[model samples]
Target: MQWSIITIGKPGHPWVKDALDLYWKRLRHYARFDHVVIKEGPLDKVEQQIQAVCGKDPCIVLDERGRSLRSVEMANWIEREEVSGRKRVCLVIGGADGHSPGFRDKAQVCWSLSHLTLQHDIALIVLAEQIYRAYTIMRGEPYHRE
Candidate 1:
């Protein structure tokens, strides 16, 4: 299956960008992965851009009010999607103001990385790393531990 992460704006922090790149590289062995960037703009515009990128693909939105899943659960969810022939999945990460109610409502699944609020850049990095961790767990690699 293919996976896409659509986010608002370019990654700003050098460290976060580098870390996310590292994870993206690692993820290549598991699935086709794309890191899509939507230019930062007004809330409605950004939301539109994100939605346009997502199209009708199965989507997972990152929001504070979303469900929290463990790494294993994430891996299982991805596996299930693949098994079910849902070949493409897009994960949306909102900009500074976060997602609109409509955007969240449209997602097939909404995931919360943490209860504590995180900057968009940091959340992007964390999402990348968690994806890598989930894949490693699936592959029986030692990258993640209980």
Candidate 2:
């Protein structure tokens, strides 16, 4: 399955970029994956930017208001989604100010990283790493286990 993350805003922090890149490279071995940065703008503009890049496909938006899942549960959820034969799975991350209500309404599923707030850049890195972890767990790799 092809998986991609389309976020609203460029990753400016050098450390966040580096960390995201590191996990992204590691994930490539497991699936077809890509990380895209949408130029920062107004909420509607940014949502439009993400929508344009995402195209028509199944997408799970990442938002604090979304459902929270354990790592194992997330791994299984991804596996199920891929098995369902979806062409693409787009993970959307909002800008620094967070997602607009309209954008949230459009998502097929909304996911939460944590209850605590996270910076947009840091959230990108965290999301990337969690995806990598989920794949590893699905493959029965030692990376994740209950």
TM-score of each: 0.95, 0.94
Q: Count the backbone clashes (under 3 Å) in each candidate.
A: 0, 0
Among these predictions, the greatest lDDT belongs to 1
**lDDT agreement with native, every candidate:** 0.88, 0.85
What would the per-residue lDDT of candidate 2 be over residues 1-146, giving only the tens digit for each residue?
Answer: 88888877788878887897799789989889877888887888888878887789877889888999999998999899889987788998888878888889988999999887787888788888898999999999998857
- Weakest lDDT window of 10 consecutive positions for candidate 2: 8-17
Task: Give me the runs in candidate 2 sitting further than 4 Å from their true place.
Answer: none
TM-score of 1: 0.95
Whole-model lDDT, model 1: 0.88
